[model samples]
Target: MVASSTTDAELSPTVRVLDPEGRDIRFVSALDPAGVVAHGWLRASHRAPDAERTLPYRPWHPHGRLDPLTPGAAVPLDIEIWSTSVVVDPAGHRLAVTVQGRDFEFPGEDPWPRSYGVDTKGHAIFLHDDPDDRPTSVFGGVTT
Candidate 1:
């Protein structure tokens, strides 16, 4: 997550599983270019990890209460991409992880922004292009 869009908001975004051929690798769903490998949601103010429940590989958020964020607060989040086993072709296949925003759209794909987070009209059903969740002022900077 970049920065808090509001005092308290719900952030729901999907991590796309990509293939070398410009296609989202999908095992299910009939939606075109649907390669949603992992998805998770957490309140902007409820990102604290549960010490007892969190593991080395997976993080557990207590979600017991809300701790709203200060506007423009840069928050660090731990998003887990479910473990997966993939055999890549030696020719040109590659396994990589890239953090994507809502501006990305494939050819012939829906042009509208589609995100159902706190405040959204629901544009591209699966594409995570919610302006409310991603403010250019926050995401545009280089993160360490």
Candidate 2:
């Protein structure tokens, strides 16, 4: 994996995407909080096995694929937070996630701007890219 110098203070909602084996598929540094990509045009990307998925915006892709607003596209949550619910939008194509720690804080100014880790439990939803796209797997070790 490419060593990323980007920090968490710059990111609004940060998070990490882990595989079923508990390996980090990718890191989403800015989208960790509840308000980051909650609205507007954004992207979300991920890879599961050989599939690399990318969404252009939120509210579900009209061409089909992943539509969180759609009835069937809702990824069942095995985790929850704040008594509130969140869904993965079909529009946002996740790219990279930010790691926790560092000297940055959300909703605050910083000497060095960076992204923060998002709540990766129930909000940790992403699209599994299908074949025909690049299929190299990216992995990260577990951290508490």
Candidate 3:
């Protein structure tokens, strides 16, 4: 893993992707100055073992492939996050994630910025919002 020089004050909570064996495959932070906002490991469906075992409805491409974080490997991923939403682009092998502002204060009366994710096609996936009691869905389409 590349060492980060950013301090806690400059770093936002990170979203991590782990392999099937629970190994850290890749991670991304919104705090990055480069606008790298998000990234994760990916592989073509044909390269993945038993791809049909999960989510049979999704289509897989035999020629598609995502560059592995490691030099050479086919890694399956499990996504995890503390306070962000992630969107995957299966065909493009990309991940887009939401990141709350570093100044955001939770469980307080003050207003804070909201964070959200977008799919490869640019559809919104809401992540953070005030009034925590409101019912919501992760798959909820863009709200007006």
Which one is best on lDDT?
1
Predictions ranked by lDDT, top down? 1, 3, 2
Residue lDDT tens for model 3, 1-144:
111111111112334343444333332344422123332221222233345543443334333453323323324433223344655333435332433322122233323333343221111133233334222332122211
TM-score of 3: 0.16
Query: What are the runs in model 2 whose C-alpha is more than 4 Å off?
Result: 1-13, 16-85, 103-144
Please tell me which model should have the higher lDDT, number 1 or number 2. 1
For model 1, the superposed segments whose C-alpha errors exceed 4 Å read 9-17, 29-34, 96-144
Q: What residue runs in model 3 are displaced by over 4 Å at the alpha carbon?
A: 1-15, 32-82, 87-144
| Model 3 Cα shift for residue 11 (angstroms) | 16
How far is each candidate from the true structure, as Cα RMSD in Å?
Answer: 6.6, 17.8, 17.9
lDDT of 1 by residue, 1-144 (tens): 556455554455454545667555543333322444444555556678888988988878877886766676777777554554545555654444444433233345344333444211121344343566555554333332
Q: Please report how far candidate 3 places residue 47 from its true position, in Å.
A: 47
Q: How many steric overlaps does candidate 2 have?
A: 37
Give TM-scores for every candidate, taking all chains together and pairing residue i with residue i: 0.54, 0.17, 0.16
Worst 10 residues of 2 by lDDT: 2-11
Candidate 2, residues 6-108, lDDT tens digits: the string is: 2101111334333444443332334432222221211112111112332322123233332122212322211111122334434543433443322122333
- Please tell me which predicted candidate would have the highest TM-score against the true structure: 1
